[model samples]
Target chain A: MVIALCVTVALAIMPLVGVPKSWILYIFLFFIYLAMANMWNLLAGYSGLVSLCQPAFLGLAGYAMTIGTWLDIPWWAGMIGGSLIAGLFALLISSAVFRLSGVYFAIGTLVVPEALRMIFFLWRPVGGAMHGAGAGYMIKGIGDLSPHVVYWLSIFVGVGSLFLVKGILRSKLGLGLSAIRDNERAASSSGIDVFRLKLYVFIISAIITGFAGTIYYLYQGYIEPTATFNVRWTMTLLLATVIGGIRTVEGPVVGTVVVVFLYFLLARYAGYSLLIQGIILVGIMLISPQGIVGILRRSKFYDSIVKRMK
Target chain B: MIYGGDIITPILMGIMLGGLYALIALGLSLVFGVMRLINLAHGDFVVMGSYIGYALMRNFGIDPILGLIISIPVMFVLGFFIQKYLMGRAFAIASEIPLIIAFGISLIIQNAHQIIWTPLSRALNTPYSHMSFHIGERQFPVSYLLDFVAGILIMLFLRWFLKRTYLGMAITAASQDKRVAQLMGINTGRVYGYAFAIAMVSAAIAGVFLGMTFPFTPTSGISFLTIAFGTVVIGGLGSMLGTFIGGIILGVVQTIGGYLFGPASQMLLVYIIVLVILAIRPQGLFGK
Candidate 1:
């Protein structure tokens, strides 16, 4: 928690000394990275939904926020409303698609988001057609807020998301979720309501993702179907969670920092960037399923921390 | 508008186009059926095939059709190695990781293609490009008719191979149940690699045909991928016959959409069809 707070404070102060606007965008996206990784970890890592269609929820939040802005709601309110809208969509989808286990569920989830992207492309006014819809509201009072302020706000969201997730993990709901992940049949036999547990986690994951999406578009001042529903975003978040160490709290933050940093640095090169990212992922997954943080946790340095605490 | 020219021509053209789509999707379906790997780079192989065709023709004046004899085998070998080295391990991890890894490969290929070919579109540019028949009021491209026949023949041959050949049967068995097949003395990993290789061969051929039919560029495969995926899903998972029907439906849908809404909106409209179909039947039309 202290680490997260320090990271937030550092982000808040970075832009004052002549950092480029591109770096600020990168910083804003860094918080988004944290949120996305955690949300995915909650579902696939902890609860074992393993659904690959997290982008669909992101899309929902983006479109919902856009709709809210058009209706003259404040940006924050729009973001909250958008998050709720996305949660509803997740609930509706989880019931039908989550029936399949393992890869089938993952593939089903993937198809859902790709389909949603196409739907938005077809729906015109809903997705703002090809050019995409803007935030509809100009920033008025927030001009006094530096890039640091924007960065800190994003950090707060990321930290709050982590706590919310931590709380869920500590609750009875978390027990049910872990049980469902371990063995759905055994968990049901033990008197746990499996479907309800799955639904709760899936919805919670979407809600957090939606909140991130809403803030993302507000920061960018635009929303487009392709960008919002991008498969690349889903892949990035998944990589972060997996390579950071699935089913752990600190894993996502570590994973996101590495992956997001790589993305920002390499993204300018287009094709070369993809090659490097792909090789890195393939290498990581092959060598260590436990990921970087997982490996680190087992090391002597981390072991010493536990020894000291004891 | 009468005399068979206006309506028959477009419908005929659409059918041939649909045939091409089935050819490309065949590799996708086959790999998914047997290995359960999507080969996110399947489309990239198609892109590579086009470039190979373009290079052969541009540099050596080699016939585009003849160039396939070399490129197909080359791609097959490369794909075999990819499956053995890269994708083999990925199959053990959860499905999403492989997909993400494939996405990275796709990005690499996209850039590699950009660097090698430049980002500009290229075509086979053969003399037969202008060859077409005007039978009564209907116009037909000879190249397209040949493409259609080739697609059907390939599908029939694939069907025969899967049903008749010992290796093919082993592949099918492995796809159905790897552990059972392994228990039966089959090397599942070897079969998986071969299956993936064969799929890449199909994709390479489809790429040649795709370049012949339309201008080819690195980015062109992205939308084609959407359509191919839609057809695969609509036809049902791991079903070849279903892919054919799905491909045709996609073609007909796109043709009508283009007719009504113009080309600009055709992709969006086709994607909508895929979405609505999946919503209604999550298992897809031919899914078992």
Candidate 2:
């Protein structure tokens, strides 16, 4: 934990110490992705909710922030309001979606963002004319903000999400969640409020995901319905969470780094990136469903390190 | 402003559209009924079939309908291997594993289509592409009429096959209870393969019809998927007749919505109706 803190402090100070702008931008993306991936891990790995509607939260937040800026509302307030809206949306949909179980639940949640995308495409509340076939809005007064401020906010979110997952895991709610994940009926029968626990996790994940999304679009200075609510967001989260290690707190951290690296490496081949990632996802599920962290846990080196720590 | 013709026109159009939707959804319903697995790539498979028809038409000058002969067998072999090797193995690990694998397959297929086909929208131009027949004051496109006939014929054939054939009965039995069906000496694994293969055949047929009626691109699969999912949910899980009716209802609703709220809101209305149906009656109209 001390080492983690020291690293974060050092990272927080890097921009002030005259680090290259490109490095700062990369780190900013890393932090945003890390935050999103952590929340996804919390939902899918720990809570057993394989929600595919994460883009709904993220995009909604982006839209909210963009619209708010247009109306002269402050960016920070828009961020919080956007997150609350995401959480409220989750709360409203929970009753309907929670009725379905397992794969049904997955399918049910999958369509939310698609619906939101269409609604945004059709309803341009603040805009008068269409901008390139989508109801896109630009962040107002964004020229006055420095990149470093947004970068620090992303770092705060990234570090905050890591601690949130760690804290949740050690708490009673985490134990109840694991119980529900293992067996829903048994967990409910044993006095755990399955619906409530799942709802809590769902809403929390949505809020944090929204928070991270607002930060991202704020950095980008643009928000459009199609790109904001694309399924690619879910794809990235799934890839990062699955590759790093599901059900482990440290998994998303490691996974986010690899994903960010791959993002830059394959930036030139934009079309092939999703294709390669899909192949990797399938291959990993077939060969090692537990992912890289799972493979590491079974290795001799990990055993030796654990033995030494003990 | 409100005329009987206005109401009847959309309803008529919706029924024909519903017929096509049912055809696309049949494969999804069949696969899910037997294997209890939702193939996220089902729409992609439909798109693949369309692309196959397009290729056959482009290269050999064969009609899209005739090209189904090649596409069906090819898709059957593909689906069988995918289920037998990929999905079957994933099933043993976890229930959700197959879904994720299907998602992966969807991504691969969509990207592959974009890469190979260049993401440009293409339409299969049949000889009767612009041909339509008049019924009183209303005009019905020949392509839509053909799609409706094909959908009904396939649904009826599927019902009969399930009732009369040994393999079909085995699939039905396996869908009910895998353990009991296995105890009865039915090869559940092989049945799943057959079920998936049959579903693929249906997808191929639907894809050809879809190509005939609409222009499609690589990304069109996702909308088709949403339609199939909505149809299955509204119609219920295991009933073929229910699927047909559900498709009709969705078709009518979408048509009417588009008429009232412009074309952009057609899919949005379908989604809203799906959510409403899921909330009120999760089992669907015909589901037991």
Give the TM-scores of the predictions, in the order they appear: 0.87, 0.95
Worst 10 residues of 2 chain B by lDDT: B1-10
The CA lDDT of each predicted structure is: 0.76, 0.88
Ten residues in a row with the worst lDDT in model 2 chain A?
Answer: A127-136
Predicted candidate 2 versus true structure: per-residue lDDT over B1-288, tens digit per residue:
112447677777888889999999999999888888889899999999999999999999999998988988999999999999999999998777798899889989999999999989999998896699877899878888888888899999999988899999999999999999999999999999999999999999999999999999998998899899999999997788899889999988988887777777777888888888887888788888
Candidate 2 — what's its lDDT?
0.88
Runs in model 2 lying further than 4 Å from the true structure: A9-26, A127-130, A303-310, B1-5
Q: Which ten residues in a row have the lowest lDDT in candidate 1 chain B?
A: B1-10
Point out where model 1 deviates above 4 Å: A16-23, A99-104, A111-146, A304-310, B1-11, B92-100, B134-136, B140-143, B260-262, B276-283
| Residue-level lDDT for B99 in candidate 2 | 81
Candidate 2 local lDDT, residue A120: 88
The lDDT of model 1 is 0.76
- Candidate with best lDDT: 2
